[model samples]
Target: MAGRSFLLRVANVNPANVLTHTDRALYRSIGIFILLYGGYAIVGAASFVDASSNYTHPWWQWLVGPPVAAAVIAYDRAVVGRVAVNYEHLESADPHRLLRRRTAGLYTGRMVLALLFAIVITEPLMLARYKGEIDAYLGTVHNRELARLEQSGAIAAFQRQIDGLRAQDAADDAAVADLHRLAESKRSAATSAYNQALEDSRAAGVSRRAGCPPGGFCDALVQQSRSLNAEATRLDQEASTVRQAQEPARQSRATQFAALNEQIEAQRTSNRTTVESAAGFGARTAAMWELVQRDFWGFGFFYLGVAALLVCLDCAAVWLKLVSHGNGYERAEARDARRRELSELRRHQQELRVTEAATDVADAGLDTVVREQRLLDAAVSQATTRLLAELEEQTRTALTPTR
Candidate 1:
């Protein structure tokens, strides 16, 4: 009995208005369908949230389903509850036709809403049905997306810049090494020549000291050695200057290389993130479409079938209400509604009559008051005239007293 009452409430039917077992069963059926649709909505919403890449909180994602289900339940209850039967229509010659005509717009509107809800609820379930296939398909999609990003002009440009910087650094290093080698060769030759000149000068000093004077070949040889030493010193200074000049260039290239590498890495990370986050609703839908396109006869039929079933489930209560018109429960409900309306109308008439009677009584009292005031004014005027006449008579008698 409690369960029946709950189902009646779910069906938006008053238990007192249900007059037959068939009516009771019908309402229970409607309530069952409504509950079923609500359950389906919850499942669909949960699947939608779970499949989405945007919502990262797994625990919170499940929480989204209940509120959505509640909303759907509320809407369904309202739709079912508002479909009040017009009792007067039952009196018509063709009651069912009349009822349909009266509620056609309402039925159409509810069906349209049902269809919308069905689509919203159906797509996610369809995606879930083909979860494995869609997941695999999404893998391909992510790979393709990543590949596209990597091959994009921006990434290519970055790579080109990096390669160019590396090549320039390499060429600069090689050029600097060549310069060092050239300087070393020149310095070595100059050192060798300086040593040879010193030895020759020593030999000349030894030989000339025994046979000659002060200004001799020994002094010339010493001067040659000094010139060779100066050449070696100049070569060393030039090599140091070349190295100093190339050092700043190398450092600048290194800085540029580091910065470019960072940019390239950042771009790659962004591309990876984009590809990884592509498992969203839109992506899944697109993947589903691809599956449909690939095997239209097999997957497409199942997809449409699922959607049709859900739409039917969503519209079942409304459809039941639509068709079960002029039934015992609806007739009772209609009679109750009509009875209440007539009762209200009779009460309103009674109040209006009471108000009119009160108005008449007030008007009668006002007329009586007006008539009494008029009669009082006439009596006062008559008394004033009588008093004046008496005064006039006294005055005349006094005036005639002398006779």
Candidate 2:
């Protein structure tokens, strides 16, 4: 697919949905990139894991990787579920049928893919973030130990003694340097003087060879050359004096350096013993906490940077899901949920209809019971009236016969 087409997929959920053919391809590409990046992170994490464990004691001192892996994975799943719902709602007419279908392999596949990102990508970055924190933590630990030794006047006293020696050593070193400079100046002057004196002597000889009268220009020239020669000799003597003066300073420097070296070696030996006497990784790690605790800004920046990268991938995955108006799984689930709802509604309606029919039958039975009760009451009343009439007629007949 063209890069533009991929960009189109990335533009929005709508475009992602519209580009049906490219969705899977883009997803695969994105997945591969995420996996590769994550792999690189894992390699770094491996190194960090070993080193951190050595310093911190419990190897799991690298705490950032696992939880982050789990969280990222959970997020990926939630995204998938949401997208599935959207697909069913928007795209599928028969969502119920789709819902019944179980694609365990598909979900499992996604989870496996997400694992590559979570463990490899996110976990390693977390380790990367902690690298400086751990190092600083370790340094602080060592410093604190050193400080404790100083406070107790163990290493500190020794160091102080050495410090004094070192100070003298420094002074001697400086003096030696001055001496060397002086010696060099003297040597240069001596060489120049020697050359000048030699040249003057030669000139004086030439004047003598020219055979000028002893009391005239030759004599004056000879006197001038001798003066030059004496000046050169004085310069040479001065140069030798400077060299002799430098020797003492050089000797002092060597003596001071030897003493300083001896003191330093003693301090080194004591340090090794004290360090061995001290506690192990725990104390060191505790010291490291000082450094690690202060690196919040650094940690935050790394976290945000890694988060941004992962979030982009997350967004892309989400966008892919949003764009797919309906995937088979989504359609199936939506259809199934709908079917279940309709089935529940129909069952409720059936129950209501049965109840209504039973009510009607009861009402009819009630009416029949009422009619029978009324007929029974009327028969009883009519029978009593007829008996009373018969009795009265008999009484009147008997009375007439008696009159």
Model 2 lDDT per residue over 335-399, tens place: 55566666777799999999999999999999999999999999999999999999999998888
Q: What is the C-alpha lDDT of each candidate?
A: 0.76, 0.54
Q: Write the per-residue lDDT of candidate 1 for residues 2-31, one digit (tens) a residue.
A: 765998899887888787888888888989
For candidate 2, list the clashing residue pairs, or say none. Answer: 17-323, 95-335, 95-336, 96-335, 96-336, 98-332, 98-333, 99-332, 99-333, 137-288
Stretches of candidate 1 above 4 Å error? Answer: 46-53, 58-67, 83-101, 162-260, 347-365, 399-401
How many clashes show up in model 1?
0
Give the clash count for model 2. 10
TM-score of each: 0.69, 0.35
| Model 2 quality (TM-score) | 0.35
Top TM-score prediction, candidate number? 1
